[model samples]
Target: MKATTVQNTFDDITLWNKMREGDEKSFSILFKRYYDDLVSYGNSLSPDKEKVQDCVQDVFIDVWNYKEKVQSAVVVKAYLLSSVRKRIARLYQRDHIFRKSTSIDAVSFHMEFSVEHELIDDDYATKQKVLHLNNLLNNLPARQKEALYLRYHQGLAVEQIAEMLDINYQSASNLVYRALITLRKEWKGALSLITLLSSGSF
Candidate 1:
């Protein structure tokens, strides 16, 4: 019999299922696929890059160790993201400095947005607008910033975000909606820029 190969083109759920069946190639593919995204999301939650990286690694390790016992996830990306968040929270709990912060909600999110200069026009006015937009995004409340990041950057649905953040659907929707409303209120003339940002053009 020919050896089976795992293709990167396979959807996450398919890879996840293969992994559960002890397919190392599928597991490796899944890891390489989401590792960077997981690291980026982990860094947003905790500034300690080493700790975040460790937590992300531990998440994969745990999954592999208990692959037979773990249930299949409807959305593999969301599941991995939620696992990273919980792992980081547990790590924080073990640290004396963050002992009081037991919940992921208490963790501050540090999300920053930047537009590549080459991606936009070279005019000074457009540059200033981009800077202003980045400033506004970085100033949003932690929860709002996180919500927007999941929705816009990760392409996660509101319900998936709610589950990942442990919030209700309406709250998740409101977080995104209010974030956009606040941006529009503060930068009324930048609607097109906002649309581009939401569309992940940046």
Candidate 2:
């Protein structure tokens, strides 16, 4: 078993080198090896099963496109992680935006009312705040929002999230932390609105 592990590692290193030189078959081998793991990692981030699968497929396609210029340190693992991290982040951000904007009537209603005035109507304010949270989420950069969703909503560990996205754990950690910081800063108003509504003080 130990010998098999060593051999697989050696093969991966060789395949990575070939992939950097534009070898399609090498890329394919790496894809097959990592595909299931990547999908599993993504699924750990969100309950939306289809989105997780799509993100993993997109990650592999991205690696293929950037194969010629992609350089791995020792094996393809890190490169794959980084690639998928970026892809997942973008996917979540896209999803957030679509979910927020899909309801035109809700959006129109929000736009028509004043935030301060809505505070007097508890039920209305609560609904508005929910929409506002979605709005804030939609406005974040694709990468930032995904990092936040995967970390906060999915409850995945940093290492797992990093592995799924093909990023260094530190980098993934930073993305998740930074995204939260940005959200706290940018969406505090919406959060406050929700708090008020929930407390029956709106």
Best by TM-score: 1
Model 1: lDDT of residue 186: 54
Tens-digit lDDT track for model 1 on 56-124? Answer: 999999999999988986788888998999888877778846445577777667868664556556678
- For every candidate in turn, the CA RMSD to the true structure comes to 3.5, 13.9
Candidate 1 lDDT for residue 44: 87
Q: After superposing candidate 2, which stretches have Cα over 4 Å from the reference?
A: 1-9, 98-202
For each candidate, what TM-score against the reference?
A: 0.88, 0.44
Give one clash count per candidate, in the order shown. Answer: 0, 7
As a TM-score, model 2 comes out at 0.44
lDDT of each: 0.81, 0.57
lDDT of 1 at 135: 81
Segments in model 1 whose C-alpha atoms lie over 4 Å from true places = 1-7, 97-101, 186-191, 198-202
